[model samples]
Target: MSLSDKIKSNPSFKKIAHWLMIPTGQHRPRLWIRMIVNPFKHKRGKNSIIRYRTRLDVFPYNHFDLGERSVIEDFSTINNGVGDVFIGDRTIIGMGNVVIGPVKIGNDVMFAQNVAVSGLNHGYKDVTTPPSVQKVETAQITIGDNVWIGANSVITAGVTLGKHVIIGGGSVVTKSIPDYSVAVGNPAKVVKKYNFETNNWEKA
Candidate 1:
């Protein structure tokens, strides 16, 4: 097998790698890794603004890319420890947002305050092990262009939100939403769909 594959197959090596990326007893990356490694491994587009107060728990093992002119406002937390986080051009990640990756956000997306987009989930099937200590699972969450995610909305794991989609405030999205739709409420359901011939949004 190739060297990278071989390393992954070994659990001890994987543990060591995790330790190097993260600290001894913390979820966040070590200072050295953040300062030295991530800058070289990740991609940051031109004119992208990641505010100074933002908590970036990004690691070098996974891809973390910000597209051109995208802005991540203050108090936002982005973690790419388990998977890639890609945000397209001119996207605005508003204040107090939490984004955990394996997430792909398209261009011109607008996220309001306190939105949480997380693909990382903790396994709780093992009764003997605490959920916090159990293995974590991830699924990709895809968000398309010109989407607007309202305040306090949550886009859960493996959910796909298509282009021109709108998510209402305080919604908990658990399933995939197709293009040109509006979803709301807990376990968010599409309440509106764009009718082509009528050229208006009608009830779904």
Candidate 2:
């Protein structure tokens, strides 16, 4: 059996491992300790840093995958309920962010504080049915490489962001954003697009 498999089956070892990972908040634990404890319970890659108090709510633990050198800051929550989350290499999930899958985040993506990304939406089509009791609709969210999402932004279900995209702070993304665009405001609109012919970014 693999080391992870063995560790999972051994209650005593698992307890010991968890104990060593108890965060003190004064100093971060070693990389190896994080690797062993894997508090997020995801299949993590090498050199990734998950700061103190970050939570990953993937029941089976195998539903989440984080790439190499990625960082999930403190107080962030990643939920993969009934879905999967795949984060590519060198991504940074800032503090106080909440990401709900099925969501695919490509390489070198950066999200500022308080950014919310969700792949599920509550269905309210039936007015007779209470909102709380309404069925939920699920969709896949795809974020391409080298994207930067500003602080306090909300990326709703079914939204896809292409590569080299930049979202302004406080923006609400409700649609697909094309590549090399700068989007901002509620129901985010593209304000700028890269002009390859001019070798610059120009007004959209």
Best by lDDT: 1
Q: Tens digits of per-residue lDDT for model 1 on 14-81? A: 88887877778898999998899888988889999999999999988789999999999999999998
Give the whole-model CA lDDT for all candidates, comma-separated: 0.95, 0.86
Off by over 4 Å in 2: 1-41
* Candidate 1 wrong stretches, greater than 4 Å: 1-6
Query: Where does the lowest 10-residue lDDT sum fall in candidate 2?
Result: 21-30
The prediction achieving the highest TM-score against the true structure is: 1
Q: What's the true lDDT of residue 94 in model 2?
A: 96
- State the lDDT at 108 in candidate 2: 99
Candidate 2 residue-wise lDDT, 167-191, digit = tens: 9999999999999999999989999
